[model samples]
Target: MEITFYQEVDSTNSEAKRLVDGGKAPGFAVVAKRQTAGRGRFDRVWQTPTGNLALTFAIPAPPSRPDLPTLALMTGLALHNVLQPLLGDRAQVKIKWPNDMLVNGHKVSGTLIERVGKVLYIGVGVNLVSRPENVPYETFSLAEVVNITVEELAEAVTAHWSATLAQWLETGFAPLCDDYNAHLYGRGESLRISLDRERAEWAEGTCTGVTPEGHICLADSEGHVTRYNAGDIDIIRTLQSV
Candidate 1:
């Protein structure tokens, strides 16, 4: 639980990876007040200037569950639990399967995890005070919708997030899935899913929550069920390009 805060940096994730690769201990968090080159999942550029949370940490990989995707989902569930109390009904925080935090169907935060050897680097970017308006997409900020300070939210998240992760590591993903589904947004809806870079398909389904291994469960149009292994298939945001 060694936390280091920076006024500004290129990316907390990048910096944390450097420390992890350099043989830093597990649970070392590198938090940046502002990230010049913040990144999202799939190398997407995350835009932020200041007054937002850009935090990353290193967790030493375990002998079991070497896959990074599982840990990423676990991290998302941790965030959901940590922030949900502060959010209340107005903030409307819900997790879009995999690891995207959405507020009223708009992306408010994202998580990116990278593994270097036995160390896993988890990056989390949360929109606290100000949200970008450059892209033709909807976004949200916790401070904009509520009367909470970034420092206040950060402290709460750090405390609750750590506890949630510890529980996941101690037990397993099943219990985590139960909590994740409770805050799930899209339960019964039609979705446009990108099968690959070259193909996209429209599927009408009910979100049956996630699998034991952290895959999203989609009960498709044909009464058949499928689980999406994170990073394999892209779940298109029906509203806008995010």
Candidate 2:
């Protein structure tokens, strides 16, 4: 697990890709103190304030080509593990389906996974000292609940991710399903999911939980359960819910 530090960068994920293109092997990480042009899923802007975390890990794709969604959930679980202890009884920490970590219903961390050739670039950002403004959803920072340095938090996350990924590779998502669901946000609440990028199609139902393969399961009024591999989920009747 090689780790490289940068004072500032456009994006840690982008730096990881450049390293991969230059013959750097998997199992290395790029971490930047600040990111000038970070991004999340759907190419949405991801703000990385100074003293926050902007890290990316390059991992070789498994022989079976593991599902990306499952991998993302696994990453979220990893982050949750690192943060749960720090907050310890101070506030509730939950994992939003796919790749987000929330504290008391506000987003505190996010993960973004991208496959490049035979490698997977997993990017993670955490609001340590401050949160972003002008975002659609409510956001929080670790500073609100605890005091910790970026380096300390990054080290904790990477260590937890290594253990989680190892277990996932050996047993798949099935064994971790229950644990992940235990910390899942809105596990059995009504949710509105946008079935398309344009939000033209919608599915409103009770959140049944996530499938073993990491797809979110929603049960409609008629009790028919539909598993969605990709979509944006929002809790019904909530403001700024991701």
Candidate 3:
């Protein structure tokens, strides 16, 4: 793993993409102390402060290009896999569809992906000690919630990231869907989802996991399953925005 550490940067994803476009290999991680212009899924501004984990990894050889969404989901699963043990049952790590990490119905971390040519840059921002100011949703850090240091959590993420990426590349999204579905938030519950433009679209029943193509499956009150590709979605009961 080749990691480039920075005291601060605009966005690690952008930097890593620049490297990949210039012919960098996979397994390269770019970390920043502060992200002046961090972003989340759907191009939303992710206000992350110093000391949080802002990492973007480049994957030079993906099994398929359109499978990038599944790859991002797998990456979030890896993050959850490493942190859930430390969180135990208290924090309740639930994975939002695509790539958002929630704790106790509140968001603690988010992931984004940008693909250039065949190389992919997967960006992740986890609130480690503090939340970005005036953020719409409630956020928690691993240290604040679970009493662990940032370095320890970062080390754990780095170690699992490699393994997770390899699995995603080889086996595709089946394993990822199973693992992520097991840790899903509000698996069988009535919920309102924000489909587009933050309009609250009500859906009842349970989460039936995702298709291999990386769509969110929400079984409605009428027993009809609706799949979401990517956009704004939140678990309505807790008002937890994802």
Identify the candidate with maximal lDDT. 2
Model 3 misplaced regions, further than 4 Å: 21-23, 61-66, 147-149, 197-205, 238-240
Best by TM-score: 2
Q: Whole-model Cα lDDT per candidate?
A: 0.73, 0.89, 0.76
Candidate 2 lDDT tens digits, 44-129? 89999799999999999887655646889899888988899999999899998887999999999888899877898999999999
**Candidate number with the higher lDDT (2 or 3):** 2
Q: Which residue pairs in candidate 2 have backbone atoms (N, alpha carbon, C) closer than 3 angstroms, thus clashing?
A: none
Model 3: ten consecutive residues of lowest lDDT: 196-205
At residue 179, candidate 2 shows an lDDT of: 89
- Pairs of residues clashing in candidate 1: none
lDDT of 1 by residue, 1-242 (tens): 77888888999988887776677777878887799999876677997678898888778876666443567777777788777777777667778777778887777888888877777788888888888887656788877677775566667677777887787778777777777777765656544445554345434355676777877667766778877774332234453444
User: How does model 2 fare in lDDT?
Assistant: 0.89
Per-residue CA lDDT of model 3 for 12-50, tens digit only, reads 998887776687676688888789999976578987787
TM-scores of all candidate predictions against the true structure: 0.88, 0.96, 0.88
Q: RMSD in angstroms, all models?
A: 2.6, 1.2, 2.4
Clash counts for the predictions, in order: 0, 0, 0
